[model samples]
Target: MITTRVVKILYVLALIPISLFSLLMAVYGLAWIDDSAAFGYLLLLASPFVWLFQVFATRIVLEFVINQFKISEYLRAIKDKG
Candidate 1:
């Protein structure tokens, strides 16, 4: 759950580009902006894959942090002691 929380946070953080591009898309759709449509569409198409990569990447990073920070060891110790 903890790792998942971290992953969710990181995943949401990773969505910044998508959100920004969504806003840009909205603007383009409304004809308030014209020059950014292609770029917006590019990001729109790429963002899901990018976020998927971010989720996996965040998991890897969190796994490293758990080991490097000894959080998993502490958890195991607690479970054993209990």
Candidate 2:
């Protein structure tokens, strides 16, 4: 329960950068999609890498924030709950 709150907090915080990256990428990449089919296909091909980067970055950031907080207590409490 405690770490649930912690994770939600970290997830919301992490969304800030991820969403900004998405918006920025969309703004710049949309031009390529509108200009030609080839560039649009290229964007499609590169989409997976973009998703991987965002997920990896968000995980790393969430882990970092978790470590910075009193997560050990929550972990212990969770273990006791089980």
Candidate 3:
């Protein structure tokens, strides 16, 4: 079984890419501001929402994975008892 410290590290690591992606979107949107203000503003405004949604989704997935591991561990304990 993996240690809790490792799982915490992995969870934090997973968030890094998501944060980078959101930053890129904001940068791209800023770059486009001069050419198309509306589109640029749209992207800028949407970036945060997108980040929030992605984070929420990622959290759900991680929780599911953690739950699965816990379930398996519990099952193993049960089997051993029997």
Candidate 4:
């Protein structure tokens, strides 16, 4: 469970690249950029959905890990008591 929290923190930290890339792209207009570059710039500019998606992904992963850890701990306690 503790490790899972650390993982979640790392996931959040991963967003930093996305944010920085987006800001950089936004500073330079996509119109003058090449198509692929423009696309990347646009993607960065329009990445609110990406951020939201990451949030949901992190939540689901954390929830599953926490639940699994709790279940395993519970089972271990039961086995120890028995």
lDDT of each: 0.63, 0.71, 0.89, 0.69
How do all models score by TM-score? Answer: 0.40, 0.49, 0.86, 0.55
Clashes of each: 0, 0, 0, 0
CA deviation > 4 Å runs, candidate 3: 1-3
**lDDT tens readout by residue for model 1, 1-82:** 4665775676678667655665555555445225567665665565556656756766677667657557766888899999
Query: Which stretches of model 1 miss by more than 4 angstroms?
Result: 1-36, 69-82
Query: Best lDDT goes to which candidate?
Result: 3
Q: State model 2's lDDT.
A: 0.71
What TM-score, to 2 decimals, does candidate 2 have?
0.49
The local lDDT score (0 to 100) that residue 64 gets in candidate 1 is 77
- What is the lDDT ranking, best to worst? 3, 2, 4, 1
Local accuracy of candidate 3 as per-residue lDDT tens digits, 1-82: 6745666787799889989999999999999999999999999999999999998887788778888889999999999999
| Local accuracy of candidate 2 as per-residue lDDT tens digits, 1-82 | 3665878777788767776776566555666777886776576666556766887877887777667665777788899999
User: CA shift at 53, candidate 4, in angstroms?
Assistant: 0.7
RMSD of 1: 6.0
TM-score of 4: 0.55
